[model samples]
Target: MNSLKTNYNIVIVLFVSIFSFQTNAQSAAVDQLHQLYIQTINTGDPGNLNTLYTDNVSIRNSDGSLLTGLNNVKKQYQATFDNGKYDITLKTIEEQDLNEDYMFVSGSFVFTKIDEPEAVQRGTFVNILKNIDGEWKIYKSYRYPEITNIKSIVDGLYKSFAQGDIPSVLEAMDEEIIWNEAEGNAYADGNPYIGPEAVLKGVFERVGAEHEYFKLDDIELHEMSNNQVLATLRYDAKVKETGKTYNAQVAHLWTIRDGKVSAFQQYVDTKKLNDAMSK
Candidate 1:
């Protein structure tokens, strides 16, 4: 009985030791992935980015656009460097070892462009990486961004509106955005325009043509539950042909999904606007 006990004890010790070594190896492999990512971003080199991805990788961008396969991934990186000239850095928030062959990593990132004084964007991401033939690669990823940056998105869209950046402004809205103009307003012909293009043609373009200085001022944002943001502001504008000015109270109820404005409701003193138009 004594001999049997000793043998059993030895087997338990060996099992524990093996587990410890395997776990260390697993962590080391995962760490390599993190290091490679940092290196790739800092370098702005597609060659480095390509090394860490599998042939069939799925990268969902912050704007909810999915880039599949190695080619699409490479193109995105190349464009960011060549056109945007942006550099990104990441830090891990949590790392989980699903098994010896797979791992999960969640982290935040800061992106800066060459001309910018500071980082332009801060975002989060969760990724799944796998080991294939002894090499670890990013296989799947769900970027927790877009709305991960609500302030930047909502503020930027309004700024674009101010600048007459029509394309940029339209691109920030969802395809099927539910946009409404205040009733009794001249542009309220379409009560709830169904999409970005419709809003562009119906509301924005008409406002541009009819108003000499259409502007939003005294803006205050109140973030609400369920991913809603309420903006209270004043619309200051002059009717072009009528040569009349009005300062009307305005409230915009915005619903965001996947980091884009999916719905928008406008409340305004439409009578004041109509009176100005009559002038």
Candidate 2:
């Protein structure tokens, strides 16, 4: 009995020791990753950045565009530096380990353009780091634009539309646009609208005539896969002739091509739209 007890105790001790060691190692690795991120941003050294990124790194911009490949990442940042000075500072908000090999870090960054002292902007970034060859390197990264800017652009769209600035609204869209509303009203066969005229006919023309007192509220943006953006907006409008108010939810799926909105699709609340129209 004494011998058996001794063996059992030894096994328990071994298990506890192993678990503790793993926990400590993980903590240390996360700390190292945080430090490495700080170092890379502060130095702005391409070589250092390369070392901290995987060979197949993917970077998603605030505009929902993606830059993939280590060489591409380097080139993009190099161009930014070449064109102007970028003095960036970062503050880590949270870090989560997805597994032993993968982790995610989210934080806010302030970028100060050297030439424009008053052009300092703050944004949030999320990076997925992978442990490769016993070191952590960024595998994927995403940046979100400041909420204020996003709101400003959205508000501008409403203002432009209200003022019958058709050209301005067209300019804001991607060339290949997919406009979807909750009302089951899909334009251009639920595909991309190739040019401005098509967008104007499908989007501005249809909505402008169908509803009045057009107001967009409760706007939210979700970054979807492959540089696509899903914008959820509460739509409130009334028929110009009937004074019938239409309150519905809409989701706009936007795809950007050549820095323009190339395609748009909308999803809307058909039941709410019908009820509002009937009234």
Candidate 3:
């Protein structure tokens, strides 16, 4: 699963549409194409997408996965629907007609889970459509990253941590970053570690001192408002002295400012962690 472990941040970009919708002759066709996009996403039916695309349509996903051709794109959507139902809304910022035969639209989209309104991922999109014979078809679809790009940043830090490059990892944070550990956690000695040094000493150092074979896995990032990112993952660690191990679900709330992480808050299953720490 290519999950963002992605970050959330506020950002704005100029919409670039390739064709002029001003030529009212194309409005109905364009609107129909837009409606088709909405229907395809909401339905999560891969087969429905086949009608929207040319035989050799190109696609790029938010998670950076790529699929070329109509069939491949269909399978991607099918997998999405098989996993969960997505209710997606599309907002077109601009539209342009590249020529009499081609058009482009760039805009934003938000995908929300039908079951849980809170589960949402918002992103930008660029679509290129072709007029083949008589029907408008999607020739290219690209998903662009948001302004804050928290997912990429957090994923970088996770990689650094895995490599034991604490110094490099700390570079991604604000000098006066505020960090908090989960309540009842062994590393809560400095609940609000005010800076990198404090976080390193109070959390990283303590973990290294008391644990062996500690690892993080199955990490996924969800973007939230006010420049915050929510990451859900699992922590697997074996306490050194007690030889007790626990694999617990963990959540980290990260707030970014000027591209640097300004604050971090951890949420984990503390009871399980506490039990693992006990002698």
Best candidate (score: lDDT)? 1
| Candidate 2 error regions (>4 Å) | 1-20, 149-151, 162-201, 205-279
Order of all candidates by lDDT, from best down to worst? 1, 3, 2
Q: Name the weakest run of 10 consecutive residues (lDDT summed) in model 1.
A: 144-153
Instruction: Give Cα distance to truth, residue 154, candidate 1, Å.
Output: 4.2
What are the root-mean-square deviations of the candidates from the true structure over C-alphas?
Answer: 5.7, 8.5, 16.5
| Winner on TM-score (2 vs 3) | 2
Candidate 1 per-residue lDDT, tens place, 49-89, comes to 66698899999887678999999899888888776566667
C-alpha-based local distance difference test score of model 2: 0.71
lDDT of 2 by residue, 19-108 (tens): 788667766766676666556555665667767789999999866679999899888877866767657777778877788898878888
TM-score of each: 0.64, 0.58, 0.50
Q: Count the backbone clashes (under 3 Å) in each candidate.
A: 0, 27, 9
Score candidate 2 by TM-score against the native. Answer: 0.58
CA lDDT of each prediction against the hidden true structure: 0.84, 0.71, 0.82
The sequence of per-residue lDDT tens digits that candidate 3 reaches over residues 1-279 is: 234222221111111222233455566776787788788778775656767889999988765567898878777777778888889888888778898789887889888888888978788989898889978888999986465476778778889988999897788887899999988887887779998888888888888999987998998988888888898999999999889999999999998765568899999999998999888
Point out where model 3 deviates above 4 Å: 1-22, 148-279
**At residue 266, what lDDT does model 2 achieve?**
68
In terms of lDDT, model 3 sits at 0.82
